[model samples]
Target: MKKKTPGDVFDLHQKIQSELNAQEEKQRSALRRSLSETKAAFDFFTDLGHDSTTAIALTDIALANVLEE
Candidate 1:
Protein backbone atom coordinates (compact mmCIF):
# COMPACT_ATOMS: atom_id res chain seq x y z
CA MET A 1 0.00 0.00 0.00
CA LYS A 2 1.16 3.56 -0.76
CA LYS A 3 1.67 5.95 2.19
CA LYS A 4 -0.35 9.13 1.88
CA THR A 5 1.51 12.44 2.25
CA PRO A 6 0.23 15.76 3.72
CA GLY A 7 -0.30 17.11 0.22
CA ASP A 8 -2.58 14.19 -0.61
CA VAL A 9 -4.66 14.84 2.50
CA PHE A 10 -4.94 18.54 1.69
CA ASP A 11 -5.97 17.79 -1.87
CA LEU A 12 -8.66 15.39 -0.62
CA HIS A 13 -9.96 18.01 1.79
CA GLN A 14 -10.15 20.58 -0.94
CA LYS A 15 -12.05 18.20 -3.18
CA ILE A 16 -14.60 17.47 -0.46
CA GLN A 17 -15.08 21.16 0.30
CA SER A 18 -15.57 21.93 -3.38
CA GLU A 19 -18.19 19.20 -3.63
CA LEU A 20 -20.03 20.53 -0.58
CA ASN A 21 -20.03 24.05 -2.01
CA ALA A 22 -21.44 22.81 -5.30
CA GLN A 23 -24.23 20.96 -3.56
CA GLU A 24 -25.12 24.04 -1.51
CA GLU A 25 -25.24 26.18 -4.63
CA LYS A 26 -27.49 23.68 -6.33
CA GLN A 27 -29.90 23.74 -3.39
CA ARG A 28 -29.96 27.54 -3.43
CA SER A 29 -30.72 27.54 -7.13
CA ALA A 30 -33.59 25.13 -6.61
CA LEU A 31 -35.02 27.32 -3.84
CA ARG A 32 -34.83 30.40 -6.05
CA ARG A 33 -36.62 28.61 -8.85
CA SER A 34 -39.36 27.43 -6.52
CA LEU A 35 -39.86 30.96 -5.18
CA SER A 36 -39.99 32.46 -8.66
CA GLU A 37 -42.50 29.91 -9.82
CA THR A 38 -44.64 30.48 -6.76
CA LYS A 39 -44.66 34.20 -7.43
CA ALA A 40 -45.70 33.65 -11.02
CA ALA A 41 -48.55 31.44 -9.92
CA PHE A 42 -49.69 33.97 -7.38
CA ASP A 43 -49.67 36.73 -9.98
CA PHE A 44 -51.62 34.62 -12.43
CA PHE A 45 -54.37 33.93 -9.91
CA THR A 46 -54.53 37.56 -8.80
CA ASP A 47 -54.84 38.66 -12.42
CA LEU A 48 -57.85 36.41 -12.71
CA GLY A 49 -59.56 38.26 -9.85
CA HIS A 50 -58.46 36.13 -6.94
CA ASP A 51 -58.28 37.98 -3.61
CA SER A 52 -54.75 39.01 -2.77
CA THR A 53 -55.01 37.92 0.85
CA THR A 54 -56.32 34.49 -0.06
CA ALA A 55 -53.65 34.08 -2.69
CA ILE A 56 -50.96 35.01 -0.23
CA ALA A 57 -52.25 32.57 2.35
CA LEU A 58 -52.36 29.78 -0.18
CA THR A 59 -48.90 30.63 -1.40
CA ASP A 60 -47.57 30.46 2.12
CA ILE A 61 -49.17 27.09 2.70
CA ALA A 62 -47.76 25.78 -0.55
CA LEU A 63 -44.29 27.05 0.26
CA ALA A 64 -44.43 25.52 3.71
CA ASN A 65 -45.34 22.17 2.27
CA VAL A 66 -42.50 22.42 -0.24
CA LEU A 67 -39.92 23.33 2.39
CA GLU A 68 -41.03 20.49 4.59
CA GLU A 69 -39.98 18.11 1.89
Candidate 2:
Protein backbone atom coordinates (compact mmCIF):
# COMPACT_ATOMS: atom_id res chain seq x y z
CA MET A 1 0.00 0.00 0.00
CA LYS A 2 1.13 3.57 -0.62
CA LYS A 3 1.63 6.06 2.20
CA LYS A 4 -0.46 9.22 2.31
CA THR A 5 1.22 12.63 2.54
CA PRO A 6 0.45 15.34 5.10
CA GLY A 7 -0.98 17.55 2.36
CA ASP A 8 -3.43 14.82 1.42
CA VAL A 9 -4.66 14.49 5.00
CA PHE A 10 -4.95 18.24 5.38
CA ASP A 11 -6.95 18.54 2.21
CA LEU A 12 -9.32 15.81 3.31
CA HIS A 13 -9.79 17.47 6.70
CA GLN A 14 -10.52 20.83 5.09
CA LYS A 15 -13.13 19.28 2.86
CA ILE A 16 -14.86 17.66 5.82
CA GLN A 17 -14.85 20.92 7.77
CA SER A 18 -16.34 22.82 4.85
CA GLU A 19 -19.15 20.30 4.58
CA LEU A 20 -19.85 20.50 8.32
CA ASN A 21 -19.92 24.30 8.22
CA ALA A 22 -22.43 24.22 5.36
CA GLN A 23 -24.72 21.87 7.25
CA GLU A 24 -24.54 23.95 10.41
CA GLU A 25 -25.44 27.09 8.45
CA LYS A 26 -28.45 25.33 6.95
CA GLN A 27 -29.69 24.27 10.38
CA ARG A 28 -29.30 27.79 11.78
CA SER A 29 -31.23 29.28 8.87
CA ALA A 30 -34.05 26.77 9.27
CA LEU A 31 -34.28 27.51 12.99
CA ARG A 32 -34.57 31.24 12.31
CA ARG A 33 -37.27 30.66 9.66
CA SER A 34 -39.25 28.44 12.00
CA LEU A 35 -39.11 31.06 14.73
CA SER A 36 -40.35 33.71 12.33
CA GLU A 37 -43.29 31.62 11.16
CA THR A 38 -44.25 30.67 14.70
CA LYS A 39 -44.17 34.29 15.81
CA ALA A 40 -46.40 35.25 12.89
CA ALA A 41 -48.93 32.62 13.83
CA PHE A 42 -48.85 33.71 17.45
CA ASP A 43 -49.46 37.28 16.44
CA PHE A 44 -52.39 36.27 14.27
CA PHE A 45 -54.14 34.60 17.18
CA THR A 46 -53.21 37.47 19.43
CA ASP A 47 -54.79 40.04 17.12
CA LEU A 48 -58.05 38.15 17.00
CA GLY A 49 -58.05 37.07 20.63
CA HIS A 50 -60.35 34.37 19.40
CA ASP A 51 -59.83 31.81 22.12
CA SER A 52 -59.30 32.29 25.83
CA THR A 53 -57.91 28.81 26.13
CA THR A 54 -54.77 28.17 28.17
CA ALA A 55 -53.11 26.83 25.04
CA ILE A 56 -52.95 30.27 23.51
CA ALA A 57 -50.85 31.69 26.31
CA LEU A 58 -48.67 28.62 26.33
CA THR A 59 -47.98 28.93 22.63
CA ASP A 60 -47.06 32.60 22.87
CA ILE A 61 -44.74 31.89 25.76
CA ALA A 62 -43.14 29.04 23.91
CA LEU A 63 -42.57 31.18 20.83
CA ALA A 64 -41.02 33.92 22.92
CA ASN A 65 -38.68 31.49 24.60
CA VAL A 66 -37.53 29.98 21.32
CA LEU A 67 -37.02 33.33 19.59
CA GLU A 68 -35.13 34.72 22.53
CA GLU A 69 -32.87 31.75 22.68
Candidate 3:
Protein backbone atom coordinates (compact mmCIF):
# COMPACT_ATOMS: atom_id res chain seq x y z
CA MET A 1 0.00 0.00 0.00
CA LYS A 2 1.22 3.53 -0.81
CA LYS A 3 0.90 6.42 1.62
CA LYS A 4 -0.75 9.59 0.26
CA THR A 5 1.28 12.81 0.50
CA PRO A 6 -0.04 16.32 1.22
CA GLY A 7 1.39 17.61 -2.06
CA ASP A 8 -0.58 15.01 -4.02
CA VAL A 9 -3.80 16.00 -2.27
CA PHE A 10 -3.16 19.70 -2.83
CA ASP A 11 -2.51 19.11 -6.54
CA LEU A 12 -5.76 17.18 -6.94
CA HIS A 13 -7.69 19.90 -5.14
CA GLN A 14 -6.22 22.61 -7.34
CA LYS A 15 -7.04 20.71 -10.54
CA ILE A 16 -10.66 20.26 -9.50
CA GLN A 17 -10.99 23.91 -8.51
CA SER A 18 -9.57 25.07 -11.83
CA GLU A 19 -12.00 22.92 -13.80
CA LEU A 20 -14.95 24.20 -11.74
CA ASN A 21 -13.90 27.80 -12.31
CA ALA A 22 -13.69 27.25 -16.07
CA GLN A 23 -17.12 25.60 -16.18
CA GLU A 24 -18.63 28.41 -14.13
CA GLU A 25 -17.19 31.01 -16.48
CA LYS A 26 -18.74 29.23 -19.47
CA GLN A 27 -22.12 29.21 -17.76
CA ARG A 28 -21.93 32.92 -16.93
CA SER A 29 -21.11 33.85 -20.50
CA ALA A 30 -23.98 31.74 -21.83
CA LEU A 31 -26.38 33.31 -19.38
CA ARG A 32 -25.37 36.79 -20.48
CA ARG A 33 -25.97 35.98 -24.11
CA SER A 34 -29.31 34.39 -23.36
CA LEU A 35 -30.40 37.37 -21.26
CA SER A 36 -29.64 39.84 -24.04
CA GLU A 37 -31.68 37.80 -26.50
CA THR A 38 -34.56 37.48 -24.06
CA LYS A 39 -34.50 41.19 -23.27
CA ALA A 40 -34.83 42.16 -26.92
CA ALA A 41 -37.77 39.87 -27.36
CA PHE A 42 -39.25 41.13 -24.13
CA ASP A 43 -39.04 44.72 -25.31
CA PHE A 44 -40.81 43.82 -28.54
CA PHE A 45 -43.57 41.99 -26.73
CA THR A 46 -44.00 44.86 -24.27
CA ASP A 47 -44.71 47.23 -27.13
CA LEU A 48 -47.27 44.84 -28.52
CA GLY A 49 -48.81 44.61 -25.07
CA HIS A 50 -49.21 48.38 -24.87
CA ASP A 51 -50.83 48.47 -28.28
CA SER A 52 -53.21 45.70 -27.36
CA THR A 53 -54.16 47.39 -24.13
CA THR A 54 -54.92 50.61 -25.94
CA ALA A 55 -57.02 48.77 -28.49
CA ILE A 56 -58.93 47.02 -25.76
CA ALA A 57 -59.58 50.29 -24.00
CA LEU A 58 -60.89 51.83 -27.19
CA THR A 59 -63.17 48.84 -27.70
CA ASP A 60 -64.58 49.14 -24.21
CA ILE A 61 -65.20 52.84 -24.64
CA ALA A 62 -67.02 52.27 -27.88
CA LEU A 63 -69.16 49.56 -26.31
CA ALA A 64 -69.98 51.81 -23.39
CA ASN A 65 -70.95 54.65 -25.69
CA VAL A 66 -73.29 52.36 -27.60
CA LEU A 67 -74.95 51.16 -24.38
CA GLU A 68 -75.51 54.70 -23.14
CA GLU A 69 -78.47 55.01 -25.57
Candidate 4:
Protein backbone atom coordinates (compact mmCIF):
# COMPACT_ATOMS: atom_id res chain seq x y z
CA MET A 1 0.00 0.00 0.00
CA LYS A 2 1.14 3.56 -0.69
CA LYS A 3 1.58 6.13 2.09
CA LYS A 4 -0.77 9.10 2.27
CA THR A 5 0.57 12.64 1.71
CA PRO A 6 -0.04 15.77 3.82
CA GLY A 7 -2.28 17.25 1.08
CA ASP A 8 -4.48 14.13 1.22
CA VAL A 9 -4.88 14.50 4.96
CA PHE A 10 -5.74 18.18 4.58
CA ASP A 11 -8.41 17.38 1.99
CA LEU A 12 -10.00 14.79 4.24
CA HIS A 13 -10.06 17.21 7.14
CA GLN A 14 -11.74 19.85 4.99
CA LYS A 15 -14.36 17.34 3.82
CA ILE A 16 -15.18 16.40 7.39
CA GLN A 17 -15.47 20.04 8.41
CA SER A 18 -17.83 20.78 5.53
CA GLU A 19 -20.07 17.88 6.53
CA LEU A 20 -20.13 19.06 10.13
CA ASN A 21 -21.05 22.60 9.04
CA ALA A 22 -23.90 21.28 6.90
CA GLN A 23 -25.28 19.23 9.77
CA GLU A 24 -25.10 22.20 12.13
CA GLU A 25 -26.99 24.38 9.63
CA LYS A 26 -29.74 21.78 9.34
CA GLN A 27 -30.12 21.67 13.11
CA ARG A 28 -30.35 25.45 13.31
CA SER A 29 -33.02 25.50 10.59
CA ALA A 30 -35.06 22.89 12.40
CA LEU A 31 -34.82 24.84 15.65
CA ARG A 32 -36.00 28.02 13.92
CA ARG A 33 -38.99 26.19 12.40
CA SER A 34 -39.91 24.74 15.78
CA LEU A 35 -39.78 28.15 17.41
CA SER A 36 -42.00 29.64 14.69
CA GLU A 37 -44.55 26.87 15.13
CA THR A 38 -44.56 27.38 18.89
CA LYS A 39 -45.12 31.11 18.48
CA ALA A 40 -48.07 30.52 16.12
CA ALA A 41 -49.61 28.09 18.57
CA PHE A 42 -49.19 30.58 21.40
CA ASP A 43 -50.88 33.33 19.35
CA PHE A 44 -53.77 31.02 18.45
CA PHE A 45 -54.35 30.15 22.10
CA THR A 46 -54.19 33.82 23.09
CA ASP A 47 -56.83 34.75 20.50
CA LEU A 48 -59.00 31.83 21.58
CA GLY A 49 -58.84 33.03 25.19
CA HIS A 50 -59.84 36.55 24.16
CA ASP A 51 -62.80 35.24 22.19
CA SER A 52 -63.95 33.09 25.08
CA THR A 53 -63.82 36.01 27.50
CA THR A 54 -65.80 38.25 25.15
CA ALA A 55 -68.42 35.54 24.61
CA ILE A 56 -68.81 35.01 28.35
CA ALA A 57 -69.27 38.70 28.94
CA LEU A 58 -71.92 38.96 26.21
CA THR A 59 -73.73 35.94 27.59
CA ASP A 60 -73.85 37.46 31.04
CA ILE A 61 -75.25 40.71 29.67
CA ALA A 62 -77.91 38.81 27.70
CA LEU A 63 -78.92 36.88 30.79
CA ALA A 64 -79.27 40.07 32.85
CA ASN A 65 -81.46 41.70 30.19
CA VAL A 66 -83.73 38.63 30.01
CA LEU A 67 -84.11 38.49 33.76
CA GLU A 68 -85.04 42.17 33.94
CA GLU A 69 -87.78 41.73 31.31
Which candidate leads in lDDT? 1
**Residues 1-69, candidate 3, lDDT per residue (tens digit)?**
888799989999999999999999999999998667555544555566656555556555554675598
Quality of model 3 by C-alpha lDDT: 0.72
Pick by lDDT: 1 or 3, better one: 1
- Clash-forming residue pairs, model 4: none
True-structure lDDT of candidate 1: 0.88
Which lDDT tens digits does candidate 4 get at residues 1-69? 989999999999999999999999999999998667555544565566656556556555554675599
**C-alpha displacement of 33 in model 4, angstroms?**
0.3
Task: Give the least accurate 10-residue stretch of model 1, judged by summed lDDT.
Answer: 57-66
Per-residue lDDT for 4-67 in model 1, tens only? 9999999999999999999999999999998898998788778878799988877787778877
lDDT string, candidate 2, 1-69, tens digits = 989999999999999999999999999999999878776766677677656464468677777887799
Runs of candidate 2 exceeding 4 Å displacement:
50-69
What is the TM-score of each predicted model, taking all chains together? 0.76, 0.69, 0.58, 0.68
Of 2 and 3, the candidate ranking higher by TM-score? 2
**Model 4 root mean square deviation, Cα atoms:** 15.1
Clashing pairs for model 2 are none
> Which of the numbered candidates is closest to the native, going by highest TM-score?
1
Cα deviation at 31, candidate 4, in Å, is 0.2
Q: Please list the C-alpha lDDT of all candidates, in the order they appear.
A: 0.88, 0.80, 0.72, 0.73
Stretches off by above 4 angstroms in model 4 are 50-69
What 10-residue stretch in candidate 3 is worst by lDDT? 37-46
Cα error, candidate 2, residue 18 (Å): 0.4
